[model samples]
Target: MNDFLELVKSRQSDRTYDTTRAVEPEKLERILEAARLAPSACNAQPWKFVVVTDKELSNKVGKATSGLGMNKFAKDAPVHILVVEESANITSLLGGKVKNKHFPLIDLGIAAAHITLAAESEGLGSCILGWFDEKEIKSLTGIPASKRLVLVITIGYSAKAKRQKMRKEKAKVISYNKY
Candidate 1:
């Protein structure tokens, strides 16, 4: 596989993280920079990323990501990145309303993807978590009520070995010209 394809294939969701291992500052900065450079609709860039490294705060944020045994591994992650959704620019907002689309949400997703890819390139493990207690997380992070918490990314060293990735054949997922 080509270098880009290999990098994409190697990236995976890692829930089991090495609690003793901490992410390097330079690596985290690069990941954040990648996310910042992600493209947004009309370049509105309606997003904010809050990085949580404090152990106590991380535990609280992790608790918000956990319930019913889901995302239990988040509690052990050394870094948590909160992707907060902000309102888009006037043009993007009007375009979204007129076109019946939520551009900010799409922009946030793109940014999150950039974050994960950058983390993988840095040799760190990451998991994009959407299931979380928004209220609890907001209280812990002091995020404004106006901003919506879109995604929480857990970053750390992988404690578990990589498993082979499973995917449908390209023929099943892609089509040429017409559907």
Candidate 2:
């Protein structure tokens, strides 16, 4: 996947992973670097990435993500990047208030995208998980209760094959100048 569009097409939510393998430190560092370089409104960079690699702790965090028959595969993933929302800079705060938009959340979303894409480029599969026990995870990670954990990204060598993407047609989603 040298081409960017092809890379985008190939990336998917990988639910099954090869648990025996561990993500290399170099590759993980590059992925984190990509997230660090993600753009933010007013360059606030209002987020923190908690990279979880320890087997014992990862299992606990993964267990917290599983409940109500959802995200059971998270426990098998070798790496989990916990995205913690942080305070935004003054400029981003004022701009968001004036525009009636929450820029930090949006900024964090962009960072998540960067992380997943970088993981793909490193030949690793990733899944962005929004459903999890936030309180339990916070306690495990020792994160402040006040801060919000926005996303938990699982990354590892995928055990499942790539499936065709099901999406709406471009004609239905795109427009020239008018709605």
Candidate 3:
């Protein structure tokens, strides 16, 4: 497989992370760099990332991310990245209104994809978590009340082994010119 294709194939949501292992600073930097380069609507770049490395804080954020048994594995990860949604630039905002879509959310998703791929490339495990207490996380992270808390990505070395990828048949999901 091509390098990028191989990376994509290998990447999966890692729920079991080794608590003893710490991600290297250099690798973390590269992952963040990849996220920073993610494409955004009209280059508006309406996202802010908060990386939590402190054990206590990571635990707090992780616990907050887990609501009603959801994302219970997050507390074990060594790092948690908060993807905050910021105001888009004027052009992107206008385009979003005209297109009847919120471009910032799309932009944030793209950024999160980049981050997960990069973490995989760096031999780190990652899981993008959305089932979190938005208001609690915002307060815990000291994120401005006006900003949107979009995603929380847990990262660390995997304690569990990689499993085979399961998916629908390509033919079933793909289409020709018309759906």
Most accurate candidate by lDDT: 2
> Order of candidates by lDDT, top first?
2, 3, 1
lDDT of 3 by residue, 1-179 (tens): 59999999999999999999999989999999999999999999999999999899899999999978799999899999999999999999999999999999999999999999999999999999989998888888899998889999999999988999999999999999988
On a 0 to 1 TM-score scale, where does candidate 2 land against the true structure?
Answer: 0.98
Assess each prediction's global lDDT (C-alpha) against the native. Answer: 0.94, 0.96, 0.94
Where does candidate 3 stray beyond 4 Å? Answer: none
How many backbone overlaps does candidate 3 show?
0
At residue 144, candidate 1 shows an lDDT of 91
Each prediction's TM-score versus the true structure? 0.97, 0.98, 0.98
How good is model 3 by TM-score?
0.98
Clashes within 3 Å, all models in order: 0, 0, 0
The weakest ten consecutive residues by lDDT in model 2 span 1-10
Q: Which lDDT tens digits does candidate 2 get at residues 81-158? A: 999999999999999999999999999999999999999999999999999999999999999999999999999999
Which residue pairs in candidate 3 collide? none
RMSD of 3: 0.9
